[model samples]
Target chain A: MRVTPAVELDDVSFGYRPGQRVLEGVTLRLGEGEFVAVAGPNGGGKTTLVRLILGLERPGDGRALLFGEPAHRFSQRRTLGYLAQRFELGGDAPATVREVVSAGRLAAGGLIGPMRRRDRELVAEAIERVGLSERADAPLRTLSGGQQQRAFIAKALAGEPSLLVLDEPTTGVDAETQESLAALLDRLHSELGVTIVYVSHEFGAVERFVQRLVLVRRTIVFDGSPQELPGIWHDPSHVHA
Target chain B: MLESEFMRLALGAGIVIGVLAPAVGFFLVQRRQSLIGDGIGHVAFAGVAAGILLDVSPVLTALVAAVLGGVVIEVLRSRGGTAGDQALALVFYTGIALGVVLISTAGALNVDLFQYLFGSILTVTRTDLVVIAALGAVGLATVGLLYRALAAVVVDEEGARVAGVPIGGLNIAVAALAAVTVALSMRVVGILLVAALMVLPVSAAGRMAWSMRSTFVLAMAIGLGSSLVGLTISYYADLPPGGTIVLAAAVVFGTAVVVSAARGR
Candidate 1:
């Protein structure tokens, strides 16, 4: 039997202050095993939408569901991996590369119970997947920015999440790291069948990698394959900038 | 050379504070609000002065005020209306000013404010030890139970929240813990140096270790070792216990810095 949509946001509305609707009657859905991107300008409710999905904020109206259950009641957070846009790692945090990645397994209860042999293997796999196995013993502060980002991804992947939601993971990364991350995303979605929902300011190989494109300019502008994007501008003043 | 009951009490108090200070200091450093502990310590001084004025145990007064001060600081931080540095300054000045005023008006002209300012393990009592011991046990248990969640929040608060960690509650709880440490260590390290005990040991450990758990262990070891050694040195050299302990911590901290630098970051 086919699984339901990974996430469904129905008429969700929210804002910081009263009488100011940041996201007014927004609705969207994500299917299982689908690679989707939610693209929009700054202050266009993109991050807010992600936050709603991550259960960080409650909608002012309507309902949200994840994996066919009420979002709040969905306790399978261990199966969900997220990389927020405003990522901050404790700078003076003493965590080494291996330990930092191991944090990803915290949701999986890796620290509470004894780690099985398989868990150790998975931890090593996560480190290797991030291409930082050599630096596994090093502290997080010692890594370069790109390596740190990769380590964070390793942390997210450590739980073997069914769905990976990343909000602008390539913000401060170098070109090579960005490409590598993109390639990794392709591998995760296509090869591993993990659902992917991400938001980005720019589109690279994402157009080729993503199965669906959700162009959200404060509303559901479009939700379809990337190749079907219209060449002609819908708005007269629409420019790349 | 070891015939003084006063010295024994002082040594015991110093050892207890040594463990308690670093225990709470680890989380403060983790949150990167090491200075907030200093601010709490100053507020605790006001509490101490209040106790002295009313003929009450200074430790009791300090505990009440330190907890209240910690809550106020936490409220300000969560409100996000004021800059952290500004709030810290406000709390620091108010605490010190109030302490000075109360001490002056109380007419205890013989009371040396220097002892409160510089600390004296010699002044610790059996009651003080009991209070410190109880607070220390509570702090340790809280930290142990909340270690994972605290670690998650300290590293990435929003991320931790998204990942189902209770960020706000844990933050307040940690603030309370720091306040307890501040109140307890006031007699041993003084208001000015209590924050040093928290920051120096953690920072030194962070330079060498690569995990929060390991860092905590290393900091505790360093703190305990330094405090004991400092106490012995002070006893033999006829120096102040607080100064000696702080100096020992400084020596360890200096060593860590040199080693990290030499090892090339």
Candidate 2:
């Protein structure tokens, strides 16, 4: 039997206000182990699409499914890793790199219970995988932007998620850091076989890493291999026929 | 220190409230909801006034009202009917107005509202002590059990939701805990000064601690220390106990700020 697609949006529609549709009739599917980049101009519903897939927001119409289950009913959240657009250490509560990564284990058993031995091992392994083992005990604020981003990725990796969703993961970092993030993600995809879906408005740095590109403009205007994108987007406001 | 029965009861209740208030307040500060305590304090006042109107135990009534107010605040927040601060301000002013109206309509001017407003540690009876102990125990237990969920929500609410942390339930749980803490604390510091106890010590702890766990321990220690020292000073100097205690906490916070700044933090 064929494995289910990691994410599926069928004729999905969503709006923040009663009549202002952000995304309308958006239908797309991503098979397991696929590396897909969703690129769009600002206010083009890229974040909204990610929110719908993460079940943070429901589609106003049609359906959103994850791993063949309806998004709202899919409770095995441990299998899905999500890095929000604005991840930051809150207020004065200083968290170390290891502590930040350990939060990924929250899905296994919420913040109240004891973590199994396996959870510890996974946290340690994720820290190492993200190349932050040396800074595991360092406070997150002490790390560079790149290192902090890696720590967050390690946090996502600690859950051992098969489907990883990142929203604007490279919004603030330097080009070098973005390149390193892209490399780390490419490795996770090719080696660990973690399916990746990332949303970004800036595509120059990330385009080489993704196998497929989904250009979202209120709706998915383009979905094809990365090579096919340049020929079609002479102007972003209007797509080529 | 434990010479008189009233002194003993006062000290006992002080210790309990000291530990419990800052423990809950740490998360409040983390989530930038420190003002929720102030809002809940006003609502608890309304509860107390209504209780007086009905000839009921004011503490019990305050507990119920504060909890309901907390839940309402969370519900309003989740519904996005208004901004968080706007919603809280609405509740805060309405609660205080309702309290004033209830007190006047019942002609409870002779009911010693000042005692509840500014606290009367010497007036704490055996029944008051029991109520404080029970509420303190429940409040602390809830915080302990929900430590991780609370931390996750405070750190990143949207991330916590995606991880299936039940954001709505945790929000209300924290709010209710704040309400209970406010009600129990009213016995020590009074409704007017309760938010100080909840916030100052935690702010001091946050200045020094490097992690969430350490912040909790340090905040509890500071809270307990302030209460004990304040109570002793009040006993010797014949000062108002609640004001002394709150002033002590403020001193600790100010000292922490200066010391941290001196250390080039």
Candidate 3:
């Protein structure tokens, strides 16, 4: 029996302004439990595509579906976990690692009322999964960039989402930290069997990890296995095109 | 001091503002919108002037004006572009200008800016105290009911939005609460402490709190302590309550600053 696709974009088009398409004629389907890397140059609309899939934007035409429902109207907020671009997760938020991570449960647990016992346990488990259990109570500002990123990932994990979408998770981290992060994500994907969509300009960090790679520059330029990554994507200079 | 009816009213108002300011101000300080309470206070001055001219209670008119000003600021800031803060500055200047014009028009009557700029114990009636208490309770309820979602939005708007946190509603709720605190505190501690009470205690608490809930609770404790001490000392020394209260909070803030610096932060 075939399961419903985790995400589907059928001839979807979008633009911040009319006649200025940021993404156009995009047709894609991500299977359940698949790990995919979406890469592109700056302003290449990779982020826009993920945003569309995450229900942050609406398509100008055609349908963008999440689990066979229209993406924009997908109301199971708890089922989707998102880690935004790096700079967007600033360090001066005045919250602890556990505090930020526990917020992942907000979409699962209602905004008001105390956190259920299971919610607390989930938060702790998420922190442990990211290897930051020792610094769980520390302020986010005290951590290095990679650790902070891990804290945010733990935040996403605490929700126990069925699908995890990470945008620029490796931005500003060193290569070593990036490798560790990729390893952590790979571990999470295999263990949890969640649909993972990783968006980044530097897809090489997760290149060996994602099952399929899709390149975007206002549209889908490539979609295939990592071993088949086109030569043009290997050149940083051609990325600007 | 304890025997006087006026003292009793002042202390009651103090207790309420102690609970009100930091409850809402925690989010304001976290979001770097520390100046918003002050902005609401300025617009509230215009409301006070208009109230005096129309023979209505200044607190009610100020509440209306401040909430409008707060919503306006939130809307402008929510647009999220280069023009946001500049637009807020524009509103701030215009509000005071409008108040000055209104006060001048009321010059023929016995309108004292000093009374509102710096609170008067004599002007605070039992009825005024009741008004402050009721509205303050409502503001606290708003914060308590929406604490988690509010924190999510404050820490990460886009992330919260993606999580289905109602960003617009929560932002407006915060703005509305700030307005309520400004209007109520203006009646008790004056506009000076109205804004200071929101920002200072939260700043001081930030130095020590490792978690969001701790910062929120500790800030409330500081606000409450400052309110009680400042009002009591001002009554005994015949000093300006607003200035004294703000000084009390500033002292806590200064100590916190030293603590932060000493720790190599």
Taking chain A by itself, what TM-score does each prediction score?
A: 0.89, 0.93, 0.94
* Best lDDT among the predictions, by candidate number: 2
Q: What TM-score does structure 3 among the candidates reach?
A: 0.93
Off by over 4 Å in 2: A231-241, B81-85
The clash count for each model shown is: 3, 0, 0
Tell me model 1's lDDT, rounded to 2 decimals.
0.78
Q: Interface RMSD for each candidate model?
A: 2.7, 1.8, 2.2
Ranking according to DockQ, highest score first: 2, 3, 1
lDDT of 2 by residue, A1-241 (tens): 9778989999999999999999999999999999999988989999999989977788999899999988977878768888899878765777778778887877765567567788889999999999999999887888998899999889888878888999999888887787789889998889899899988886656677789999999999999887887755633422121
B1-265: candidate 2 lDDT, tens digit per residue: 6879999999999999899999998888888878889889899989989999999998889999999998998777677745865887799999999999998887886648988898888889999899889879988888988886677666666666787767788889999999999889888999999889989999998788777678788999999999999999999999999999999999999999999899876
Q: Top model by TM-score, which number? A: 2
Q: What iRMS does model 2 reach?
A: 1.8
Q: Taking the candidates in order, what DockQ does each have?
A: 0.42, 0.56, 0.52
> If scored against the real structure, what TM-score would every candidate get?
0.86, 0.94, 0.93
lDDT of 3 by residue, B157-207 (tens): 777777777789888989999998998888667875588899889989988
Model 1: CAPRI class? acceptable
User: Candidate 2 — which pairs collide?
Assistant: none
